[model samples]
Structures are given as structure tokens and as C-alpha cells.
Target: MCAASAFVGYSYYENQLLADTTTHLLEHYNSNYVIQNLQGTVVNTWVSWNLIQGQTLHVSIVNDANLPEDKITAIKDAILSNGTITVDDSLLHEGPQGTSSTRYKGWEGALANLQSLPTKFYIPQSFAISEGSNGAGDVVITLTNDENPDGLSGYTKSISDGNQILKSKITIYQSSQLSAMQLGAITRHEFGHALGLAHSTDPSDLMHATIRTDYPYISGCDIDAIKGLYSGDERSQVMCQ
Candidate 1:
């Protein structure tokens, strides 16, 4: 890790996959994202070798009342469409962060910035709760506090149990560095990797390498790629996945 001003680092473990599937952590912007995929096949231990493992993906979503529930779910569904996504209830409402929460400041900053953008980052709460719970690890969030030091904004990553449960020990950020558009889009994209999908060079898809303009939209091709892996008999493989 660099100094507090520029914190970033990258380490890799050998072959490690849950049920032999890949997990990508969005390559993370400024290297603050966590790629949770590496775990011991034995269930409790994390894959001490590779960068991806652990089938259990625990992520806490973040946002303010300004963001609609439906929009968040849409993003959640997009991620669930590939694999499991979970959000800890502890971080969902105001219960976890409490009043003097550090997440409050960044949440306000992030929300204010998102509101300024003309994008409709809204999703149905029902969809968010249901789709996320539809077997994929998904979580609807509000208090933002995962300790990802990438300036937050719009970063996504595939987290392993160790990084989440051991290293950061945080499933979500306490500071509000992620934008509404980012919160939804990055989770969907990163989760895609969790399901074994890799980064695509296509900027028109959510699985694109970077968050290019309009890249948040899950393109038909990207969707097809995901479906192909689980349902269509095609193997899923992409860079970093």
C-alpha cells in the first residue's frame, strides 16, 4: 500500500476458484476494490494462493434517499444475473453506521454528486431485495462504509472471504466515496466476474474493462456471455476473471 494520499497494491495467488469459477474485482480503480473469490475448497478457509476464491460474496450497497430502490435492484439483478450477491443487513439501514458515522459525510458527498448527474440511478427496492436474494450474494445498502480507499466514486471488485472477513473486515465502506451510478454499475460488473465472467474490451457493455461512458448498461452481448456460461454450455473466461 502506498501512502494515505495514494493507497494501492496488488498481489496474486496461484490457481484457486470456487467450483472452478473465476471472480474478478474490476481491476479496481486506484486499486481500492477487493476481489473476493479465493477460498479453500473446504468451505471455511480462503484460497491462500490465488486472487479469486470464496463463493460467499458479502457486499454492502450504499446510497441516500435520493436514489430510488428500483434502480438499485436493477443493478443488483444485473449482478445476480451472473452470480450471488449479498448485502449485510447491518449496513443496510442506519442501524449499523449509527449517528456519528464516518460514512455519513461521504454518503452525502456522493449523493450530492450523483443527484447533480442527469442519470436515473433508481431501482425498485422489491427487485433489489428479491433479485439479490434470488441465490446470489446481494445486499441493499444505505450507510456506505467498506474502507475501500480508492476515493470511492465508482469502483467495483470481486472480494474473497479473507480480504473481507480478515483483512478489511468490512463488507462495505463507512465513507461515501461511491456515486449512485457507480454503486449500482460497479457491483453489477464486479459480480459478473464473481460468476466467472471476465473483463470485455467492449465499451458498450457493463463488463467492459473500464467505466467508460454508457458502459454501465449491461449489453445483450455481455448478458449473452453470462447466460452462455451457466445455461448455454459455453465456458466463461475473460481477463482478470
Candidate 2:
């Protein structure tokens, strides 16, 4: 009887050790990421962009709820055409960093293969809006019929896995508060977040957290932000991550 009791005690001890190890591992994994803001001092947040292999990023939309198909198409188009913006001539000048602060205006190379956004049939409804990547190197957008609190237009949640952006989810709420054109513009703004662009201090930019109805299209600041992100320069002011 004593020997059987001893074996049971040993088994229990082993299980405890395993549980401790697992807990430690989880703590380490969760501690791997951090979030920061760009030049803006506003309450808005941004994530570092993850540049995938071949410098190509794929976009997918979650349409499981059978939301309006036309709206989905509108969002997809907005993403592909996001890099287009007219720069302000007054802001064009070479910065002290050897690269012009406005150099991102000419960054069409990043979107050379820009294509229409596609629809995906499945995506998890529940997810942790965390700091690192969600294990997918692409952007996923979801449309909801629910109302957004605080009279906000839309929001983007990005995940990073260490230094790279693992995944980003953009949520757009459907409401009568916004016309179809305004909704499309909001999608473009969220897509900027998925691309690792932060909220711009300038309200005229689409990357601004609260998009202006008058400046619906992407702006020079938005273009510069993306260009700086993929510019391969370590000192660019528009930083990711």
C-alpha cells in the first residue's frame, strides 16, 4: 500500500512541474510585443507594419454574416487604390535625414501588384485584439451591423508577432449615419491601419483616426506614411511597430 501511495505522489509531482512549465512559457509568449504611436499625440494608436516575403501583402474580408456584397467590394477597391494621393507642394522639402519628409509621395513601388480585395468565407468571430501578429501576414476586414459607441466611424485592430505584423482586423459598422461613399472612405482608413499606418495628426489625411468627410481619398501624409514604412530606411520618421 505504501509503494502505491509513493507512485501516486510521484505522478502528482510530475503533473505540477508540467503545469508550472506551461505557465512560464505562456508568460514569455505574451510578453513579446509592444505598441506605440507615431508623430501624433492624440489618443489614437498604431501598429508596426510587417513586410512579408516579396514585399506583397494580401487582403481578405470575412463575410460570414452575409453582409452587403456591394459594400464589401467597395472596401476591397479602396484598399488597392489607397496609395494614390496628391502631395502638398508646400510640404515638399528634403529633411535633415537626407530623405525628404515628403519622399513617400512617390512610393508606388509598394503597391505595384495592388489588386482588388477578395472575400473569404470564414474568419473567427472571437479573437484577442493583441499587440503581435495573429499568425497571418495579411489583413482581414469584418463588417458588422451593430452600432459603434461614442459616435465613432470605424476601428482597426492589429496583431504583431514580435517585430512583424501577424494580422490585422478592421471593423466597419453599417449605419445610416454614413452614406455609402463615406463608408468606403472609412474602409480605406482602416486598411491603412492594417498596412501598419498610424493615425495622422493632420485631420485631412485618411489615416487620421477620425476621417474627414471632405478629404475622403488618401492624402499625401498617408502616401508618405506607407512609403516610409516600406522604404527600407531605418531613419524614416513614419515608423511602424
Residue 106 alpha-carbon offset, candidate 2, angstroms: 15
Candidate 2 local lDDT, residue 27: 24
- What are the per-residue Cα lDDT tens digits for candidate 2 across 122-156? 11111112122333336666656665564445676
True-structure lDDT of candidate 1: 0.37
Residue 40 lDDT (model 2): 21
Q: Give the alpha carbon lDDT tens digit for every residue of 177-222 in model 1.
A: 3445455566555544444455665443456656543335444445
Give one clash count per candidate, in the order shown. Answer: 45, 9
What's each prediction's TM-score?
0.37, 0.54
After superposing candidate 1, which stretches have Cα over 4 Å from the reference? 1-143, 146-175, 232-234, 238-241
Candidate 1, residue 138: Cα displacement in angstroms equals: 6.6
- Whole-model alpha-carbon lDDT for candidate 2: 0.47
Give Cα distance to truth, residue 201, candidate 1, Å: 2.4
Which one wins on TM-score? 2
